[model samples]
Target: MTHVSGKRLSVALAVAAVLATACTGGGAAPKDAAGGYSAQPKQTGTPKDGGTATVALTPGLSPNYIYPYPPAAANGTVVARGLLWRSLYRPSGEGDQIADAELSLAEPPAYSPDRKTVTIKMKDYKWSNGSPVTADDVVFSMALLKAALAESPANWSFYTPGQFPDGVTAEAAVPDTLTLRLETAYNPSYLLSMLTLLYVMPSAEWNIARTGGPHLDYKQPKHAKAIYKYLTKESESQSTFASNPLWKVVNGPYLLKSFDSTTGSFSLTPNPAYSGPGESRLDQVDFKAFTSAAAVLNQFKAGNLTVGTLDSSFVSQIAALKAKGYNVYGAPAPARLDSLVINFKNTVNNFDKIITQRYARQALQRLIDQQGYITSRGVYNGAGSPNYSTAGHGSPYPPAFGDRPPYPYDPAAAEKLLTDNGWKVTPNGSTTCERPGTGPGQCGAGIPRGQTISFTLASANAPAFVGARDVAFASAAKKLGIEVKIVTKSLNYMYANYGNTYAPATKNEWAMQDYGPLYLAAGYPSSNTVLNTEGSFNLGSYQNAAIDKLINASTFGSDGKSLSAEVSSLAEDLPVLFLPTPHTLVVWKNTLSGPQSSFNALISFLYTPELWYFHDASGARP
Candidate 1:
């Protein structure tokens, strides 16, 4: 589902829009018969034979410091990768687009009956520079990814723990075809999903290993490990993203042609020699970045861009747009659940002692009144469904999350949790559990008894984050006798140097923070990218033997009824404190179309722009 941020529109999907009563901005589109958006499609007359779609861009609205680390790129990502980087055997509307459904490799990857060692035959496939994307690309990608991890082991640890073969740099397997030998039996599905991040850089072109040049010269056969660490430091800092030729390699359907750092704007075109079936519809997209919510809305009004909603409190303004027939269409956003995690890492910050308690996390969850945030706040505005599952509250895959009851949104239960834990209520409504909860008087001797436990919270503060998040949390926490100080920062600021704040010694400043899972795809009950300490997205650093085992089972185990139940059991215990994961609105010039069908709740909006062609000046949907 797509969304207009300001006013929540129930975007009903349709082909063409009818005539409008007037010409203006700030309104909602009249809902059509099928319950989709019906509007007079913005007319871009004199449509050329296809030049460039500048994509009035917002380059960094996602606020990520990195360019493409499974990080969200505004129009840039969709334009560049979607057009430039075409994966081998990638997903499509009907079937696998890159490779035939019949797994026809030379010998169909020599599998060791146990399915651990996959000997892939890279007879077909070529990179932008015309080099065959061999097993070496795969091996190189895995090795570089491993080296990429070694750069900052903690940050990249979640995806592949112990992925690096010890001193096997010479044997890291850069060759014509990849013969991946796993220590344990890995599921076929896990190997396929790994493709989401498996960007095979041309061995000679992608230099994550060599020192200078746009991308670190990863082609340097020897220093494969050292260069990855250096390149990652550059990647995280958005260092030289524009200058890197390695970054421009074609893997998907698009490639980055030009990017402007100041405007946060960029343009991309279809690769000429690219071996792919799909070609981009709009050759150019003018992307215009906006700093504040006001700037985003203002651009929409001026007709510089096409789509938008009242993400800010301009609820009334959104109504006005409908009156004038702006054909405003919107969806809340893709369904996601926002959550909070008490960083288990060592820290002297406030709440370090309190957060360690599992019950303490549960207690905080109960106090937060997640229901109110879901219902009253209208955070999703209207397009989204409130969620309670990692797989989502309701239907999708195999229904991993049974239709169980939502978490207890009871404040009273929260209070009992605090009181029963020996937290005494002071004159000022706040409660304080004795240090260590039950320690010698010395545990209480050093720290103040009634100083009111100070809790620090940090969040991305993205558009959806601004007002909806911290406010409700602050209000809920205070009622339960906790003094929480909210720290709102930019997305770029938070994912500094490495995906974490500066460091525990110099930068980490929160007891709990708004957490966005570094997870790439959405799945049933299991997740390595979710639970693996080696993944870039597993931000919370949560660890439990039972939880880890179940997640592994979910990832590698068969997708079955029993596996589904395990995920539900984990959620009940609040693996991470559940909060409302709100929807993200994609606002474009009304001229933009053909994106919704490509939405894969698992991947970003970068999937199918090749099929994303536009209508003639006649403004036809087809």
Candidate 2:
């Protein structure tokens, strides 16, 4: 979970073109500026490489583990594993949408007619230590991942029951090919999507035996457990990252050079043995941590940093930064969304009755002035739009769902819906259920007479913007005869109370939750993990047999029609109140050129630093 940078503020509307010119080097303007921006400058001459690019890292945001699988901290996943690791398929193109999968460590997979088996052809790549990255490595990595999942189910939430490395059997068919035979028929597209994020590890480094033997057999529960325990200890050795022999066998584009725990800073040098597209153009890259956005902006102002992001609070200062020849761009944050998730399982105070009511949920959605919320919150210059579908607006599947508005902001409509639903409204205050029944147009089953339409709404404590929005939501709800009491909690605490797998609703404690942007994994847009009855992220425990069917169909649904149908169904269900997609503000020096400045999924952004480069000898704009 990531925090909103700061108070939301809109960028100047007039500077859109300037920002485009600076970030894209006068290229065609982005179709949706808020969705994402490019830092790739249009060049007039040949690229000159060899310089250091300094970046500002958010303070206190450090990766606890550098490995990708078995889940590490978000920061660590984004900065450490994201940069140091390479997956079989890479996320490409702009926005959070699952762009075309770029071949990385493997070629396109070959699937059996039944779609139960897949054959992957590995690329002829080499690890930093000069060892060939072959099918054995891929198979071994899968075994380790499977072992890790079995040992720590909490970390691998994406793996469904009896799936990959569990239900599927893996074998090295050839020196360069690995075959996976699934025990059950599954969606090939979804399987491919999942593979795009898998970080293949070096088998030699990770398959060690803890008990005086050869490499531990991942197939054996005892050996797998021992290997998992050993890796866990290595992963937590934050102070020994640079010296860890196990981490030194990376196959990605950069090698860790040094780390300073005191400053939360690290530096990377291009991996000389890296065999991938867009070889490093810079000699080294330095990531420096800053306590606040102000400090980052100050460093940029002092010309001490080459690239960093500006919080919404700093959107107003873009003009000044551009005046100083810095390039600023608005990119859509990858998979990030702010939403009001209702707890359907909550039985405390009979809040479940009101929350479970479709009309009540629709009324609440309508009461929200999405446009006004974006404006006052001050981010992206109104680049935000009302999101109605479960998938984000930038998600590839939303367009297939077609443009549909289920509930427009109509306070009168909201009020009437409540009144018509048997909720009695006092002239200047909250409402009470006067007609509670199991029939249509009534506050569904279990609602008692005289029950007030009141519940607690909680937001994260940081990112003043979310709290501000919470207050605004409460104010609007109150005006329409709904009582919404706002409370603040730390992000961790909020998630503990409302996260998937574990939620306060188990004790019937929470009603509504508001927090930072929730990012979907790259390559596929499926809310199954967040919406399905058995979904790991199903915080509210919202269950619908019909919705479940749609989600299941979408998983392997072959055509655009199936995906469209699923998204369309979700848009009407109003499972969660979708909020605006916040603009990702990028601030960078004009000299840097490459894909690093362009919009890719957030996960890809942190991992592909090799694509960044200096345009000239002096690292100055040509």
Candidate 3:
């Protein structure tokens, strides 16, 4: 799963800006530049090879686990992991095109005619420990993942039962070649897309057999549990980051040199034995942690940090940063969307009865002023328009959002829909079901007469923008006779309390949730883990039999039409009220240069840091 940062401040400032304009009925405000930022800073001479670059991390947030298997891994961990390890493919290109996967550790895979077998040719790379990376390491890594999945199937939602490693057999016919023969034919491209997230670990150091047996027996639940516990515990401790013998082996650009657990800060030195492409031009890289977005800006302003991400909350400050000679680049909004997920199974306060109605959901969608919320939240200038589909605007399948025009901000339409559904509107816009029945103009089954349209919306307390949006949304809902109560909590708390696997009793507490820009891996853009009935990320436990069939078809279907049709259906269903995709702003010292592409939207500015380097004061590479 892609990491989501919960460090943005409230959008009070944005809301104030919008209120001020509306109160005065002022003309359009001056528009900032709309295009995205460049991938690298301007350079005059050859690239320098030895300067240290300091990057900024979110305040109060640090890498909790260096390993990638756990869903709780933070953005800092994702960025750092890229430096320590190499996947089979990496994100390439820019803007929406950045989702393209480029070969990294191996050549393009060769598939058999039936597409059941895929043969991958390994690159002649060596780990930092001087051991040659071979086919056996890849097979062993898969075995470890399988064992980990056995303990927690949700860890790898892409793994189908009796597929891939279960029915498939991996054979290292030669030191460089690994062949995977599957029992059933699968989409070769989709399989490769899934591999983009599979980090190939050196088996000699990660194997469970080193502790007891020759290899982990994934069939044994105890062995799987033991391996997961040991690996997770080892990776969670900051002390093990630099000292753990298991972590010393690597094949990427850098190795952890030091870590400060107290400050959530760490430094990496170039790996001398690294055999991957784009060698580290800088001798050392330091990740500095801040306490807030303001602190991060202050550090960048004071010339203390070389690379940093400018939060959207500080869009107004971009001009000032550029005036001070910082190179500001706007990354394409990640292929993620922040949404309001309505829990269909919520038994709390009989909200499920109201939420289960298609008219109610449709009315709520129309009641949302997406553009107003974007402007009031200070995200309009940097984000794309409101999305209607589950997949982002940049997803591979172009969604033909069925014949309906984008849900307009029409409170009248919302009111009409509620009234037609037997909701009695009050002068203040509060509503109650007047004619509860089992027919038209009546509330659905289980809904009683006089049931008020009310529910609590839980949103992240940080990233103040979301809070502002929630306020705006609540205000609008008031006009539609809907009572919306807003509750703000930390992102961690929100996920733990209302996440996909949360207990039904606990998950039903909140009627709706506003979080995310939930990122999906590059090339694998299907919403199986989000909208499917058994989706691991289905926080709302929404189940539609038709949707379930479509999701399954999209996942296994080889043709693009089937996937497009699924996206279209999701758009029509509106499982979650879609929000705009915000642009990711990357701010850096004018002297540093590097590849700025990112596969995940949440951490778009921190991608491919190994290629980042510094030039001398004369605008020339030293």
Candidate 4:
């Protein structure tokens, strides 16, 4: 589920600078079937007995919160949540599948004939504490997740009003099995996608509200809330993450070893008691945080970094990198989209009214140079593909978004739109409304005469391309008299504080935001909590009854075309100004040997270090 505040990608997978790479590789470098960067680089070495692998945390993103279900404002990088606990269903890095059946904590869910009841059978897994990962743990997780949402929808991005986990009731019928009865039936695929986010914790060990406190029944709502508060409070102390006993008890392959408070770097050691399928071959995985992409590139050049992403701006350095014994591979991240997130609730300068106008949004979207950004050496640098809809490239759910964009880059068309809407377009000045009435060809309701097409665009400071593209957009908008005030914020700060749903104080502070990418769940990329009217992650409060209906049809109805209808409608409606799907250039040392799936996980904002190990070029343990 893509978050508004940057998560894994950028905010919900928080931000990836919309990148593009026309060049797959120079020579000897591997390539995917599409002739793009290979998801699975060929391995020359045999599996090592045990070795350490250093992974790079995305620039400007650090794991600040340890608790899996932290508030949107408290959520940090996906690395934090993923490394600490295992979700019920692990996301299959393959673009075609929702979950990796073998890696998941539970077997594929079996739905009743009515589709309201789902029975899940747990795998033979155990927490580091040696307790079986039980049905009670699943129920406990659901209870705590519900409690978090009860506090505020801002607590969870995937939540929609009165939806899954809201009206759903769960019970552990047996030690290794659980059943969920939903008040409303959902598409089996959509429900499965939702379950992918349910990370299971050690219920028996974490049921206490205080350190050394007596264990309490977590099924009770009040007790769950108390335990949640206590756990969240404990997560606030960054320095104690490695030392905290509560954090050490894990169900995943790795356990927290040490955490650097200043740099946000952390080390993990294999969980000796991990009962999952993976070898947990790596002795230790070190995640290093950096201040910028340039720094990361420097480390790559110096051979100091093993696994990290290369910003598109550094695409020219690919050959240089490959020559340095590194494998450079990249492709558009699956089920992801980059967009200029507009805030529909912001009434400042009548932006809410102005932006609600279809033509106004079309005009603004037209000002974006998607192709220019992709081709510009300063921007995406031929590393991304143009995207115009919520359902990203190569989506299985066919998009009604035509081959040609509904609103392509055309300054003249943009100018005509403003002028036709009764705005006085000044080529080098502010375009102001001349007609105020809410009638045909007049400025919409509450937009008084003299209203200007101007708004603050909050751009993420990292991933250099984000700012470059934003500046280009602003420059284009300026030609049509749209005044775009550019303000830069850190990627982490944007993910933690930019959205109006979570940060009420910032409601009027920003009109548009570009933090990076919003990653939908793999395989089934539904726009339930993203574009829905009451969506928890609907950061801009974009409301359209028709869109809401379409979203509902896709989410609740079983019609195969429902999602396509939703995606097409969103494409035409311009819910957010969709940008290109940037290719994330994943760079790693050639010595690392693992299944292609492990490297592919990076594209989905998931990390599987337990499956990765360091090996020598000659197929020997390093």
Candidate 5:
């Protein structure tokens, strides 16, 4: 983890950058201006690099894959991206996680230059099959992420399709490079994020035409969106992407050699012929897995933790590690934010899902107390501030920071909003909806005057979520006039089929749900992925055009636009709110220093393993 530097220049620069984000619509960062570091990285680092750096992280598994292609926190994907894959473009250490941020891909043509198109040249690289990595691969991947069902069938950040308000079309404009044509001015980093954000299927591995395989053209409108589904869903699962020549079609420094599916452990070694910037410095990287985080510290003490994330409880141990002359690092978190996400597109009968009411759900923003929550958890280095509402809009940009007004805490206002909307609060505060006095047929006078709503909730087995957030909200709702019953189950079952009835998936069990999206980055629950009404990441399905428009405008301005001024001001009103910023302290030997690089900020909890180098990190570069 990067240590908190009090250098006035760096702090001033940091303030100016985040202030640019806060005032992006033109607001200023917090009063201190120098305290712009985000309190917690909601996500972890996937920043590009190699070497084994064991650390403690929470929710360390993916949906089920070796790559972040499907995005499971605990899965092999995060690790895989770090050592094996590359994004079209990379972020400049701003924003938190995959949604709503800048990019590292080929920059768009400068408008002043009057250039309508930008051509990206690929390095002289090839798939593991030895096929040259070309513009088509990028085009293919971009098209896949853009297709309408990108989220449902393919990659995790599905709403990116709409990101191109004017839209962009990629083609093999050049033999060795791709030519991207955007209708309006766009950020290269945003588009590059797709290539950087997702695990790219090898044209060779997927048996693509360019790989001496199939002649399939994903460019066809009909086949574009489904291309993502093909590589991810159609192919058989691999035991090791490195060992299998078929799956080894990548361009990174390391390759997978062995894996243990049952234990989720895997190993990697240098790829003799990788085409990226770094050279392998270690003999090999061994990834060990455990079901509980508590065991991570003990393992690290025994020299088993290749990388480490400090849990609040292990703060003393971390100090001990530092005192013992080990490399102890407190890296500055990159792209991370934690959120209590809800999927509103959920089925009416989907009891496993939570949050059906729009205003009621938005009301959650005010009800949460972030400071109190973070205090309760207690595992941070105290360098970052609460993103509170959105990430990067303040401390990340410039000018001593710019942001919206504060989101106030008002339980009474929250209850009143629910009450004025035909809800009747029982003495105990369990609310029941009064039949609509007038409006749609079902909610109109046609229905009974008032009715009570009672249901059970289904939750994934994540301790922080199920044990803390969900339970607390359930109790709080009782005060607002609703009965919420809690049910717990394995994370796999809860994530994929919680919305389905218990009789079939779980069989004969019925319940409502109140679970959040597993955020590796500490993110706000109001971006395209989490809140866009038509966007894929809007899992909770809570739709409000006003909020959506505000979010859209905010994200556009925040990403690389001049619109920060407006968005920062709007966010002050509040969108989605978590009472506390979740944190996990990381302790390493004092031998660590410089930038804690990694695949990206998705692994911020571990403080970016790739960047971990001895304090005298000068000669270690490849």
Candidate 6:
């Protein structure tokens, strides 16, 4: 998943614009004259065969784990996995499709009439060791994946109790064909979306539990568990990443040439025996890591970096980079939503009861000034769009309240709603519940009179926007006498130690949290393991029977419209306080040329650097 940033329910707030422009050097970016920022660079020339490209890893999100399916504590950072081991189906950069047919290792799956079994035909691909990549490898990967999930749902974010690897069985019945038998039927579209995340590893080379040990059948449950344990342990030794024989075996375009445990930087070289779509033209890729975005901007200024993303806070530097011979383009991170996730289990100040009330939730949502947040120079700097639904902006499955929020930002309305619901509205003072009962106009059940709307908000320190927006939210809430106490924490710390289910002891410590963005699969964007009642990633215990039913319908039913209904319901429900969706500004050297599809930022941050090449004096177009 990708982590990536509304408010008045209207009014183009002129002062915010003035302040935004003043902070950003007056012009956020130069006009395209030709249209706007294009994902693909417009270069006219042949690409040079050998040259190293220095890429910048997202600030605070460097590759700490080389293995696919990292533990929950890893904070879901994946930059090297795609380059080392390709998934069975390559993600189609386009929003219209789930997987790219031409680049996939396997052909489009054929489903049985009963829609319970799927047969997959593998393409001719080979591992770095020159061995043919077969369906056996796919089965091996699935086996290890199930083993990982069996250990803990926190092992994989996409995991749900009875989903994907749970009741499904895989078999490689033929040399190049793999068949899967499912215990239950699922929507084909949703199933295809899940498959895009399944990366294939070499079974013959990586089927051992220890170094110099004999290989075992990965299909066996016990053996698979041992193998998974071994690989995960090996992955922990970051210092030996380049020397590890287990990490060297790959079917994708590049190989791990070296890794820097100290700085989290690494380099990749083309695998000589790789059998994939791209030319693998670049001689090497140096993924540089940084502690902050400002350092990356400095590297760009010095021409020390070739490819990287510009933080929203640094959008003002776009024109300066363009002058330095760079192609800069940006779009909202695809299938991503940034929100202030509420901890429904937090009993502090009776927050659970207050938040559980639909009116209370609506009042809290209205207090958020989305427009003001995005327009703030310290925040998104006009690099984001207002999104009220989990479906995000430009989603194929849009809520009924298209563009307009169900509860718009109006402090007066927010105060009125609270007052109507047994609250005594005291501007800039503690507003307490005057009436407490299950009846209408009363602060729902379990809430007692004199209960105040005060809760602690845990905010992530990275991304800048999370803290900026939280401060803005707290400020807005103060006007309505809703006390919002914010506590800042590192992203990794929050990911590892701040969940209701995973960290029950601290469940009451945080009433709400803003941990940047959560990315879903590219095309489908299912909320299955995220919003579901039993979802492992459901940080807060938000259990709604109606939402559960809607999720099930979208997940299992044949009708795709159910997703729209589900998202619309979620938008109105305010499970989490929706924030503005921010754009991920991708910047690369002008000399780099590749297919336009390679740079699709929307599709799970898709980037095919293997297909890119330098088109300079030595390698000019014909």
RMSD for each model, in Å, please?
A: 9.2, 6.4, 7.2, 5.0, 8.4, 6.9
Question: Per-residue lDDT for 526 in model 5?
Answer: 30
lDDT of each: 0.45, 0.63, 0.64, 0.79, 0.44, 0.78
* Model 4 per-residue lDDT tens digits across residues 1-622: 1222223332111111221111111111222322246445865566676777877777777666677876655665433565568889887765557788878899889888888889999899888988899999999999999888888776777888798888899899799999999999987768878888888988888899999999999888999999999987897888898899999889988888998888888888989988877788778888898888998999999988878898888888888888888887787776787899999988778888889899999998898888788878888887877788776755556465445678988888988898888899998888899988888889888889898888899999978889999999999988888889999988767766777666768888899999888888766778888888888778888889999998888788876567777887888899899787778888889988687777877766578777776778665543
Q: Write the per-residue lDDT of candidate 3 for residues 282-331, one digit (tens) a residue.
A: 88888887767788888877878877777667777777887776777653
Between prediction 5 and prediction 6, the one with superior TM-score is 6
Question: What's the count of clashing pairs in each model shown?
Answer: 77, 12, 9, 28, 131, 11
lDDT of 1 by residue, 1-622 (tens): 1111111110000101221111111112222222233232343434333533333233234222322332221111222432444433342221112122221112234557876666666546556666655665555565665554454443332344544232223223545556666666554544443443344555556554445545544545346666555544555434355567656665545566565655445555665555554456567544455666666666656655543434523333454544433344433222234467556553543454556565667777776654455445334343333445554322122223333333556777766666666566442366765543255322232334554556667766665644465677777777766777887776555554112321444224656666343222322223454544433345445566776666666455543333344446556666667665443333443334443434321122333445445545555431
| lDDT of each residue in 140-200, candidate 2, tens digit only | 7777777766654445556555544467777886879988888776566567656755668
Which window of 10 residues has the lowest lDDT sum in candidate 6?
5-14
Give lDDT: candidate 1, residue 291: 68
Candidate numbers sorted by lDDT from highest down: 4, 6, 3, 2, 1, 5
lDDT at 457, model 3 = 94
TM-scores across all candidates? Answer: 0.73, 0.87, 0.87, 0.92, 0.70, 0.92
For candidate 3, the per-residue lDDT at 303 reads: 77
Candidate 1 local Cα displacement, residue 458, angstroms? 1.9
What is residue 311's positional error in candidate 2, in angstroms? 1.6
Of candidate 1, the 10-residue stretch with the lowest lDDT total is 6-15
The regions of model 3 sitting more than 4 angstroms off are 1-45, 71-79, 93-103, 157-168, 208-226, 377-384, 402-405, 427-429, 503-505, 595-606, 617-622
Superposition-based RMSD of candidate 4 using all C-alpha atoms, in angstroms: 5.0
Local accuracy of candidate 6 as per-residue lDDT tens digits, 15-76 = 12322222111112222222245344654567678888998887886667777766554454
